[model samples]
Target: MGIFRFSDMPLKKKITLIAVVSSSVSLLMACLVFILSESLTFPRVMRQNLSNLAQIIGDNSTAALSFNDSRTAQGLLDTLKANPHILSACLYDLKGQVFARYARPDAPQYWPAVVWEEKSEFSGGSVRIFQPVLSGGDRVGTLYLESDTREMQLRMMDYTLVTVVVGVLAFLISLLVASRLQQRVTGPLQQVVDRMKDIAKGEGDLTKRLEVTGKDEIGEVAEAFNTFVGKLQGVEDMKLDLISVVSHQLKTPVAEINGFIENMMMGLTGELNPKQKTYLDEMRAIGRENYRLITDLLSASKIDRGVVTVDLKPVSTKEVVGLAIRDYEVPLARKGLSLELEGVWEGGMLYADRDKLVEALRNLINNAIKCTDKGSITVRALTEGDMGVIEVADTGIGMDAETMGRLFTKNRVLGKEAHRSGAGLGLYITKNFMKQQNGDITVTSEKGRGTCFKLAVPRFKPGEGGRL
Candidate 1:
């Protein structure tokens, strides 16, 4: 129903198709030229051959015609039997009357009764010629000859058969050679495409490269690709170093600033007015947020450098949830959002890193509070099979499918409206933290409804080598 466009073909097929089509067209043209040349040249050669035979007979028949020896003229005419293409022969007197005649058994009986002129022509698939008899440089009579074009026709057929056979063999050879040679071009291109796919799928192994085997265009392309990826790798390293340095340099000052604000509120300086106290409080909050951002950056840098470690041990999920909630109690009241803890801990102890579990809980609760405006937040902890599951559900502005897909991806900020002050690294770090402890985190959300985050940690059992 529709044309198959050339662009839609794969690289290898495109190359092979080009080679095969080029060879086929060239072969076709060559065959056509050969056939056409033979078609024209073969007829001329046949006419020349017949004329030579007619000339010899006319020269020898002069004596017979001048002396009125019809018998000798008949002998000259009968000599035409040597050539199978000569269908009939005749001798005409000076008055243009037929003097002698000869015809092959299969030739037609009808012929011109008299010679018309000294000329040769082709008509009705046959050649006819009228030549003048000459003796002593004087024209005496005429010699008429007629020939079938069967010999030339047969030669043309033979040429056609040979051309067809040769064309087919050449086509096969060209196809075979092209199919093998095209790999030299498409092979490198295919390798580049595969590496690109691997990078696009987040494998991100920039160290991998195409093997350069020549100094041609393909090799140049491979060199360019390798250089580009190397530059990207360098940029990534520089970014990580910058983040690590800036965060480390800022974390201490922010913590000290928050300490000084706390001391001022406790009247380490002169007692402050209400306005001064409110300003100090605001300063403390801002300092604490700055400190949190620095901590997240440091943790992310450590994760990137593969230096983050988890101290796995038996821990109570209930204690971890209680600790995480206490940190958010002030923010929850400020926002007038309800906080409900539905965790009844009758389950087995979790085999996880206690600090990492608490940090993960705090990140989830913080995100829930940030997204939610008026609705309540619920924390549910329970045991299923050999795992302890914590569910943090919030009546907040949830995400669409497009945002949800990259929710835990590093360096991807979801939406500016949803996370106005977030660095987009909290969930990424938390997910990695859970993974380090042999646990996992999952999420579910609807665009307009709400979001639910689930964190699963393995249950601890005695005599199990302290491993999940």
Candidate 2:
């Protein structure tokens, strides 16, 4: 048999078990104390009472015994008839003859024969008390008292039974009360645990507060949790405010700069020398990257606000690919990398937000331009079952496993150039756009070999322009 471990049980069982065990132990202690006291004191009390009874009988029977009056001596010994514990009584003359005697009607069946002795003994649940009768300091006769102790033993057994019954009752009552009170402690803690789970699972609504019931440890825990949530809410609000201001304010000047550069490059301002135009070309590229960063931040803010809207329409696959290629033509040319298009589905179409698809392709093209050093960047498109797959492969310093794992997360810009110029939010925003259009993006890369990005889009069906 194995002993049960208390800690493995639930809290409610622990409380109830503790209460029952404690009450039983306390009751058992009380019962043991009562038994011990009774055992030690009861025998002495019974012996003293027997001794006093013998003395009184001897004192009264002195005259009857000295004169040898059998009737008076019998009457004197008969006084013990009222006490049920006194089984038998005898008055003996100095010659050791039992001159007179009195025996209880309910006395033991076998009694010791009256021996001629001045000594008493205890045997067979009774005590034999032998006391000498004296008259004027002279021994006259002896009084013998035999007391039955069975009644006292039965009384102690009854007391023990009552003690056991009371102990059981106390244990039950204590268990019930402790179980009810234990809920007061575990109930609030359970509520707190539930609320924390809700916050963790759903949209983190830090504004939710707990009900403070009383000034106890549970209340203190609730107060502390509420305080922690308030602090987190403050931090989230501050982060959003800062991002909003920077996204809106910083984009204006950078857009203006791009606008002026375009005007100058198109000969709207003035003609430029080769060196001046080259420097202006570099500046234009930097400005364009900066503008793209700001736009990514603004898009992230919109996503956080749950305002992602996609205006879907039927678009030619060639048109989408053409726009992305033309948008990144300068970066590809600057890096001396050729663009190759393979398996372009000519007649196939897509039902998606045209701008989102083109923008996502543009980010992929820019990423390809950043990583490739030698081989051509290949663009492939084909209809595969119900979806259209657009793949962009780059022969560049590809990403390792760790970089690929966090590639689509915010603030995870990989390359040195990307870290300096990019806000690390492009792929994050692009991923969301793909998801919003019911499409997906995946990547396959190796550290030193190459990398490829695949964008899957829902193919356009008949009578499905924006909704299907």
Candidate 3:
């Protein structure tokens, strides 16, 4: 019932169906055009030949008719019938009476009555001639003739048979050509489908590629598909490598925390004074920080695995930015940095997952606070173009061009003095989160000047803002 219903059928059957349908329609049209052209032109040709023959007989009989010599007139009529194509000859008086008639019995009987009047039916056809034929102002008896057109009918039949035969041959040839064309096209497509099936079933063989034999559109599609599969396989390999490295990094910190705690429990480090207990507490805090780092790493990995789904809704961008700044207030103060919020009173709603947006803003704020010392961190929100823009600018020790270039790259930590304490996952996670929300983040930094990170969230329309 649908156009694509036959898509899943076997390739051979599809090819056959296309070939048969196309050939049948082509043959039908060809036959119609051939028959119509012949029907129109054949009659006009027969009529022209009959007119020419009548002119000749009329010229020859003019003298005999004027003199009233029946023998002379009859001789002209006999001569006219000698030609096989001239089926009938007739002479009429001025009173519209048939004075003489010559015809073949085997031909159609309508010829004799057809030639006596200005408009008359002739041997299965029609003819017309003027009575009292005039030549150089002379009067002659009315001359008329009829043609059977049986030979013309026979010729037309022969032509029709030839056209039909040619149409059938052409249809057969087209069917064969179409079948070959379909094979060439669908063969490569089927190969790609089979390879895709194998890949879906966890086959990792990257050697399989669709063969490219031509420069057509289909061949280009095959090449593009092959390139995509190659890149996907490469990503899979990199993912495996990342998991292995992250696991090892996590295990080392966990092992150190466990060993340090065990040593304290066993009193192997010596008896602890009050001051020493404080140092131990600091060590425990460090262990907790390590644990938190591991948790964040796991969260980032889950994001990469597409395990996190966002619930998008309209939320005030100002409120979200203010909340992120508030969460990092104490840390910013401790680092001798001021956290400032501007444009908070402006009402601009963004369509996004509120929780995800908050998380993304928090990461950026944390990074800004950590990297800036003795300078202010400003979070600004406003409408820009079709988007709600949130910018976190820090007057900290900014990074160089090289560091800024690799800032959002996975596992890349900008080795500036301000970034010594961070794991480099903050911006990566923030970038990914923005992408999930159909938003984007950009960074501009110059060494010792300042760093400004911009986040753009699409503005929400009234009644169009809801959970995605």
Candidate 4:
């Protein structure tokens, strides 16, 4: 889990982390190899040097040992004092008796009682070497030399100190280099992310393209993204064309038909029987619903095409709400639902577009009436913080969490039953209209309880020119 999370880290951080870890591991391995090589090589070199010195001494003392002269042999042994690590030296005759010996002033005279064959052994921080004495290809005596191992210990100490210093410097250099170089890779990635965010926020500038620096992977990605956005722009153009046809070719005819139906119901045409009246009534109702759908689709398309403009000014919340509620009075009365106006007088002027505010409120009220079977609808308005708030609450069949999650999305149906009715653009349009006017809408609902939709707009300040 930890590895996966680290792998998911931002590209810049991941690059730096990889550089630092790789440098550190490489440095560690190199240091280990250096120490191991020095350890093995140092002992062999020390043993060879000691053996050469012993061979020279044995050759110099061959005549002295053959004539049994201790002074000459002792003089030859005294040369060992020149090397500080050589603590002591001894010569043993063929009879295994000590013939002549030399010891450093501070070191003890330590030797075996009998001389053995030519060999070397290291023990207790010292090395002892027994080299054979030869004359005319015959073994004469054994020269034993004991030396302290402090030189190898000091050499190792120096190597360790140098390794630590080099490791620290290397690590710092690697970190600095990695940090500087990682920007080449991460900078382009960050640009792509920022551009994607702008597009997602509905800036809708699909003409924007990423600059490609080279024929690298990042460059490839930028090119691919540009291609994708271009295709999307083409699709959006087609959608706008379709909306244009619907506006010019469809809406006018539908409105004329609805008007004719209304005229017939009002007796502008010939009178009708009971069955005919009922049929005409149902047709009018269906015609009204179809007209609403056409208008909603047009509004949604305008919002998407970024052509919807707001004439921002100071608007009276009470007046707007009254005007919007006037259209829904008959629906409320038909449903036998009560209406309550609370805090309406206290609703301060807001910086908004009057028409947009009315449209948003009407949509919310219409939804409330459709969802509600009994109880009442309440419209409230007041000031909160720097914004004026208007709330439309209804005793309706409220939504669950899952339904509310996608409620304001375009063409998202409200419930299983809603799939048979509505283009699902009501809340989506209302929300977008509020946003264009620098206002916002939110809702709160509980299943089987009720729902409340809140519209917030900037409070009107006289000197601010009604700008949000």
Clashing pairs in 1: none
Model 3, clash count?
0
Off by over 4 Å in 2: 1-220, 227-231, 267-269, 382-387, 413-420, 463-468
Supply the global lDDT for candidate 3: 0.73
Candidate 3, TM-score vs. the true structure? Answer: 0.45
Better of 1 and 3 by TM-score: 1
Runs of candidate 1 exceeding 4 Å displacement: 1-25, 44-87, 91-109, 112-124, 129-144, 154-184, 190-205, 211-214, 384-386
Best candidate, TM-score-wise?
1
TM-score of 2: 0.63
TM-score, prediction 1: 0.77
On the 0 to 100 scale, the lDDT of residue 284 in model 2 is 91
Q: Write candidate 1's Cα lDDT for 1-468 as tens digits.
A: 489989998877788888888888988898899889888897788778877987888888888888999998898788778888888888888888888999988989766866556788899989988888788988788877899998888888898899889888888887788879888888888888888888888766876777887899888988998999899878877888899999999998888889999999999999899999999988988888889999999999999877998898888877788778876778999999998878545545889999889999999999999999988999998877878899999999999988988988887867877976767899999999989988899999997689999999998887878644
Q: Candidates' lDDT values, in order?
A: 0.86, 0.82, 0.73, 0.87
Query: If the candidates were sorted by their lDDT against the true structure, best first, what order would they fall in?
Result: 4, 1, 2, 3
* Highest-lDDT candidate: 4
Q: How does model 4 fare in lDDT?
A: 0.87
Put down candidate 4 lDDT per residue, 1-468, tens digits, no spaces: 344687678888889889988998999899989999999998888888889999999999999999999899999998888899999899999988999998998988677765578888888888889988999998889899888899999999999999999999989998899999899999998888899899998764787799987788999989999999999899987987798678667788999999999999998888888998999999998998898898888888888788899988887888888788886777789999998999997777888899889989988888888888899999999888988899999988898988989888875766774343568888999999999977899999988789999999888988656553
- Model 1: how far residue 135 lies from native, Å: 16
User: Which regions of candidate 3 fall more than 4 Å away from where they truly are?
Assistant: 1-31, 93-99, 107-117, 120-132, 211-217, 239-468
